[model samples]
Target: MISFLRKIRQKLLSQNRVTQYLAYAIGEIFLVVIGILIALQINTWNQQRIENNEELEILLGLKDEFENNLEELNFSITINTKVTEACVQLTQLIRSNSIANDSDLLDDLLVRIGTFNSFDAQTGVSSEIVNSGKLTLLKNDALRTRIINWLTLLIDQEEDILFRSDNYTMNMMPFLMKHFPLANGELTKKLPFDKKKYLQNYQEKSPFKFNIAKEEYLEFENQIWHHKHNNDYVSINELNLKDFLKITLQMIEEELNKKK
Candidate 1:
């Protein structure tokens, strides 16, 4: 192409038709400019295509990560709800004075903890996402924002669990211990700490805190263990715990729904 242009330039200089030469020079200049522009446009197009592909891949990866996260969050919520139910039931049983001795109540309380352990199982959504190194792969800004918000809320819930666990245990446990019986053999697990231990170890800011409400209910939980010490037999408060369990299940549902 350069050779062709050179030949044209040579012709324009030698030809007698100088007006025609000027027109031809202008046309050649326009053609060269257009070619450059075309090349630049093609380069831009290729770059944009690559970027779009990368963005799409990120979106898909983010979708998968969030979906799994959502499921786990929902599961945690289910467990929390069940634990809550245990609290409510234990409260009713204790407040209603349904048990003649504290031993049966203690068993119910222990069982409640067992239920809590099952429901309040440890979860690692943030860890999983962070470890997966997939958050870096997220391309959609909107999706990323949503994920961040969801994670923030989960953190808040965890914080709430930390906040309420201590004092609730301190305030409630000693009160339950007065009625709790012991050495009945009907209850299996022993109440390791007496009521005062709650206040002694009470912490609103402990990094080691479990759900305070969980332990709060556990203070009365020893009542069943007490009854077991005395050879009395009875059912724990399983039915009453269901309402909290139901709440937990709802949380799971809400977490799942968040993905949509």
Candidate 2:
């Protein structure tokens, strides 16, 4: 093709039809420019196609990750609710000075309050996308924004969980250890391996049993009250994260559908 074009240019110049030659030269230049532009346009379209496919894959991955996270979040919420309820029941019993009647129930409530629950989100897809600067590949502005917000919410939720954990570890556990036998609470827990059997094997029984005095009940109640509020904060944050996950998943679904 180059040789043919060169031959045409040589023939034009040999004829010395200067006006015609100049016109042919201009036309040839215009065709070369047009060809280059067409090639560039084709390359642009190919690049866009590759990006669209990549974005679709990212959306699919995000959908799966967020769905799993939603399930885990719901489980955490349920556990948090149980913890809150246990706190409330214990508070009622302490306030009424009726806790002395049911040692077993008190033990069960104590076990529940002592158990810690936190939402463990699957952040693999989202974190990689954000950290690797691939979030922008998600062309939908709203979806991109939601994904960023989801990461922010995850951080906020983690902070709330840490606060709750600190309260449980620092305030509640110390108080309980001082006043009550931890084995009593452990007996209430249902583990895969029989905890009661394990304790019996070890011949471990606290000689000092849990005996809450009327005056001490107020102090214990204060601990439960604060722990209840901590649980509440965690629950609220989990709920918000759940909402964000649902919205993000829905947006991902929409984007995936567009591909179909």
Candidate 3:
């Protein structure tokens, strides 16, 4: 193509058709500019296609991740519900002013609360995505940014959910294990059938109010119950979990659909 252009220039100069040569040269330059623009447009389009494909791949992976998260959330809710139920039972046992002095019932409640562990062992798809940093891999920069934001909220909420709902391990469950009076006269670090919420429905209420050996069991029960009267475990959990999860996942889907 260069050789052809040079030949045309030589012919025009040989014939001394200066005006015709200038017009031809201008026409050639315009064609080259047009070709360059077309090539650039094609290149840009291809790059965009590649980026969108990558984004699609990420979306599919995230969809799978979210599905897994949903499943795990379901399971978490089940476990937490059971734990809450146990806590409720303990509350009832203590609330009965008559049972304040009953060692057997206290022992049973402690035994029930004793069965607590960290729900951190619960694995979910959202957790995997966050850990993998794939949540940040979304290709739509805007959408990617949104995903990160919502995912952070989701993860934080999940953690809060466990912390508030269960509090089973260190903060929640009853360690019924008796702390025999130490030789040093120090108390044992055991619950002796005693113990102690918000992502979804936790009302920040102390889940347990009874200690098997507390001198003021009767008073504690009344005071704690009065203070926690507004703590509707089931209703609060349902409301918060419903609202948070709905907003989080919907944000995820909206961001996905915005992808080209």
Top candidate by TM-score: 2
Better of 1 and 2 by lDDT: 2
Lowest lDDT sum, 10 consecutive residues, model 3, at 180-189
lDDT of 1 at 243: 38
Q: Give per-residue CA lDDT, model 2, range 146-251, as digits (tens).
A: 8888888888888989998998899888888887777776555753224355543223445677866778877898999999998899998888888878877888
Write down the lDDT that model 2 would get.
0.84
- Model 3 sits at a Cα RMSD from the real structure of 9.9
lDDT of 1 at 239: 25
In model 3, the Cα lDDT at residue 44 comes to 95
**Which prediction has the highest lDDT against the true structure?**
2
- The per-residue C-alpha lDDT of model 3 at residue 226 equals 31
- Each model's lDDT comes to 0.47, 0.84, 0.52
Candidate 3's residue-wise lDDT over 186-233, tens digit each? 111232223241112222323344334556565445433432332234
How displaced is residue 85 in candidate 2, in Å? 0.8
TM-score, every prediction: 0.55, 0.91, 0.60
Residues 1-260 of candidate 1 have per-residue lDDT tens digits of 88988888888788777998889889989998999999999999998777656545544444454455445445544544544655556656656554445544545454444333211322354345446675544444444455455555445444444433433355434453343332222234323323354323222321321222444445555543333222111112222223323443344344435445
